[model samples]
Target chain A: MDKVILAKDVSLSYDSNQTIIKQATFSIESGSFVFVTGASGSGKSTLLKSLYGAIKPKQGSLIVGGVELNNVSKSKLNFLRRHLGIVFQDYKLIKEWTIEKNITMPLLINGYEKEVTLNQAESLLKHVRLKHQAGKYPMELSGGEQQRVAMARALSHNPILILADEPTGNLDEYSSQLIWNLLEGANTQLKTTVIVVTHHIPSTLNVDYKHYHIEYGEISEIN
Target chain B: MKSIKNHLSLIVALISILFSIQVFIVVERSIDAYKENLAKNYSVVVVSEKRIANSEFLSIDGLINRVEELSPDNIINRLNTGMDQKNINLLKLTLPKFYKLYLTKFPTPKEITTLRKNLFSNPSISKIEDFSNNHDITYKLLVLFKGVILVFAIVVSIVTMLLILKELRIWQFKHSERMSIMGLFGAPTWLRSAVLFRLSIVDAIISSILIYLIFMYISTNRFVLQQFDNINIKVVIFDTLNDFFLLLGVSLVLSILLATMIVLGHKEEV
Candidate 1:
């Protein structure tokens, strides 16, 4: 299978004095479900950030979807991000916009026709079981519902890859299970490559997923 | 309520700036019109040793628009106390030639001096009376009034613009979170800040309309017309088509340019 992300000896740091990820090398294959687990300060989020072109790799080449991310131009990075879906822990939805509009954001950015974008957003809202709350703003929804809306948004564009950062960290058990099921469905049904950065992997997840643990600023695969 | 306050701040600033600009234009036009009226009524009386043609006065100074000989018949008739016609004719022949020189514009003190010197350069011109003292006071007052209005307009515009910028920056901060969220989703800069641009543009249009209405009322008001009439001067305070379009264009350009500045500055900080 072709590799969707290839990082060769990548290092990350916020400043020159301290390095977060030290010369880590990894490659994620297409259509593979992967989990990255680490301690609280083990730079798991930092690694994920490099994948999405949020932060540049300090040492080596970090390639995502066949584009080199190290020193990537802003326009080029934005173009790459348009093809990828990203989920944050806080569920960064524009509170002023309706949930339906939030879901349609990615499609609109990709320059989809208005009618097509609205129809797809409606379909995704139904898929997330939030069809009743389509017109409601993000502030009006519960935390779990907001995350679910975020998940729906991630899947709205049918992205080739989804990078989720602690998607269900603050959710209830029921919401957590629902999120896990959605991730599994996207992985198995849609055949999208999924890389999630979390502290713990849920034991009830049934899908076969590769796991990578970060320790001491180094990433190593676990059998 | 908050949105209204924001819009209000921008609209008020735009109105003040546009009002200052309009006042400056009106003051400038009024001064020009007043100067033209003064030029029409004022003239220099020149006494020449010889009979100088009107063409000679034109060659003396570019300021001389027209020249007319002052007919001596009136003075001759007034002095005649049953005098003979032969003596009256001799008196007319010996009397110096008097001509009135009309200027193209109301002359400043410096211009009057230059014209005086130029007229005296011709040996035939014996005496020239420019009435500089009265002209000097009127010209000085007009200059002072124009200068004061110009400075006031400039100061008001600058201060109002700074306030507008501050308000716009606050607006940028308020929308930064939403903008950053859209930015993460790969939306372009223009798309992300579309709300800011829209608000500013709407305020610009609103301000333009308000100024147009205000000026239209002032231009047609009986009191304003009475004041201009009392001064015996005609000034075009507002031109319905030209001034309206000019203010609208200025407001739109200013708002857009300021909003772009805030957007670019926010981007750099991020």
Candidate 2:
């Protein structure tokens, strides 16, 4: 399989004095379901941030979808980001916008026509089982529903890869299961590369997935 | 109610600033009109040994315009209590020749002095009354009035601008999260700031229209008209199309400039 994300001896840190990810190297294959699991403050989120260009790696090369993220220009980074979907733990939906509009955000950013974006949002709302809640604002939705809306937004533009950081961390078990199924569906049916950063992965997942564990600022894949 | 609360300070600031500007403009125009009216009714009286020809007075620089030869017949008539026709005619001939010289516009005190100098330079002229003291006092008062209005307008504008910028910064802080999220999703700077720009433009239009209606009503007010009539001066309080476009431009530019500052501040924070 072709690699969609490749990090070679990448080092990341918020402050120059304390390194988070120290010379860690990894690669994620395209069209694969991958989970990055680690303890709290073990640099799991930092690695994800580097992949999205939110934070540049201090050393070595990190490429996402064939674009090097180290010292990347803002415009080029935004261009690369358009092709990727990101799901935040807090949902991060625009509070002033309705669920439908929230889901259409990525499409709008990608310059999709109004009719096309509206239709896409409608379809995604149905897919997420929030068609009834489409007109409601983010604050009006429950945590579970808002997460689902964020998931729909992540999948709206049919991104090449979806990077989710603890998407189900705050959801109930039922919502968690639903979100996992959706992520699984995106990986299996849509063949999108899915990389999720979480502290725990459910053992009951009934699909093939690669697991990478981070310990002491080092990452290694486990069976 | 919430919308009003959110924008009240901004609207008030805009209105106050714009009102000051309009008052400044109208007062300036009114003063100019008053000066012109005074110029029409004011003139210099010159006494000469021989009757001065209107053409001779016109020959002096800045002294040309309307010159009238005054007849000494009025003084002679007042003195003719019981005089005969021959003595009355003799009294009129003995009176000095007086002429009034009108200028095209109000002359400054220095210019008045120059005119007096030019008049006195003629050997035939004996006395010139240019009302230097009155002209000096009036000119000084006019300058002082305009200066006060200008200073007031400038102070109000600067205060209003600072208030506007501070308010915009608050709005930026309020919307920062949403803007950051949009940025993460690859939205361009313009797209992320669309809401800010829209809010500013809408407020600008609203304020501009409000000022227009206010000035329009004041322009036709009886009291305002009475004041101008008292001075025999006609001043256009406001020109609808011209003033509207000017206010709109000012409001729009100010809002946009303040908004741009806030937007650029956000970029620096990131």
Candidate 3:
């Protein structure tokens, strides 16, 4: 399988004095479900950010979806990001927009036709079981429902890669399970590479997955 | 309610700017019309030692529109006290030539001086009465008024533009979260800030319409017409089609440009 992400001795830092991820080397294969686990401040979020070109690798190469991310231009970063879906812990939905409109955001950004985007949004709203609340704003939705909306949005564009940073960190057990099921479904059905950053992997997750743990600024795969 | 307040701020700023521009245009047009009226009636009295040809007057300055000889018949007739025809004819022959020089436009004080100098360059020309004392005061007052209006317009425009920028920045701050959310989803800059642009553009249109209605009413008001009539000057207060379109264009451009600046200066949160 082709590698969706490749990092060779990649070092990341917000400033020069402190390095977060130190000389990390890894490659994620296409269509693989991967979990990155680390304690607080272990640079898990920072590493996840690097995958989407939000945080550039301070040293060495980092490639995502066949595009080199080191020293990438803003337009090139934006282009790369368009093909990637990202779910945040806080569920970064536009509060003013309706949940249905939020689901259509990715499609709209991809220049999908309005009718097609709306139809896709409708189907996704049903899939997320929020069809009854389509017109409701994000603020009106519960935390779990909002995350589900965020999940529906991430999967809406059929992106090549999906990055989730503690997607269910604050959700209840049922909501967390629902988010996991959605992630797994996308992985098996769509053949999308999934990289998730979390402190713990749920024991109930049934999919065959790879695990990478971070400690003392070092990232290593666990068999 | 908050959104309406935001819209109101931008609309108010745009109205001030457009009002200043319209006032400037009206003042300029009024001054031009007044100058035209004055030019028709104003003339320079030139006394010459001998008959000066019309061609010679034209050669003095390009501003000289026409020259008409002031026939000495009236004064000579008033002086005729039972004089014989020969003596009267001799008196008329010896009289110095008086010519009224009309200019194409109202002469500024500097232009009046230049005309005086040019006329005096001819030794045969003896005296020039340009009525500078009154002309200078009127011209100076008009110039002062124009200068004051221009400065006022510029100051108002600058201050209002700054306020517009500030209001837009405040709007951006309110929408920044939404914009950054869209940005994280790979929305283009223009698409992410589409709301700001749309809001500003709508306000611009509203302001333009308000200014148009206000000016339209003032232009047709009996009091305004009577004031112009009292001053014996005809001024075009507004050109409905041309001025409306111009104000609309200015408001749109300014709002768009300011909104763009805010967007470009925004710091993406993600």
DockQ of each: 0.53, 0.66, 0.64
Best by lDDT: 3
| Candidate 2 global TM-score | 0.94
Q: Any residue pairs clashing in model 2, and if so which?
A: none
Candidate 3 structure quality by residue, lDDT tens digits, B1-270:
646776898899899999999999999988888888889889999999999999999999999999999999999999999999999999988999999999999998888988999999999899999998988888898899999999999999899978977887787787888888888878888898888899889998999999989998999999999988887898878788999999999999998988888887888884
lDDT of 1 by residue, A1-223 (tens): 9999999999999899999999998899999999999999899888888888878889999999988998788788888888888899899898778999999999988999999989998988887889999999999999999999999999999898999999999999887888888899999999999999998899999889999999989999998
How many pairs in model 1 have backbone atoms within 3 A of each other, for residues 3 or more apart or on separate chains, i.e. clashes? Answer: 0
Give the residue spans of candidate 1 off by over 4 A: B1-8, B193-203, B268-270
Off by over 4 Å in 2: B1-9, B268-270
Taking chain A of model 1 alone, its TM-score versus the true chain A equals: 0.98
- A65-101, model 3: which lDDT tens digit per residue? 9899998887888888899999998898987788999
- Docking class for candidate 3: medium
- In candidate 1, which residue pairs get closer than 3 Å at backbone N, Cα or C atoms, i.e. clash? none
For model 3, what is the error of residue B64's alpha carbon versus the real structure, in angstroms, after optimal superposition? 1.7
By DockQ, the candidates rank as: 2, 3, 1
lDDT (Cα, tens digit) per residue for candidate 1, span B174-211 = 77877887787777898888888998899999999999
Per TM-score, the best of the predicted structures is: 2
Instruction: Report the TM-score of chain B alone for all candidates.
Output: 0.94, 0.89, 0.93
Q: How well does chain A score by TM in each candidate?
A: 0.98, 0.97, 0.98
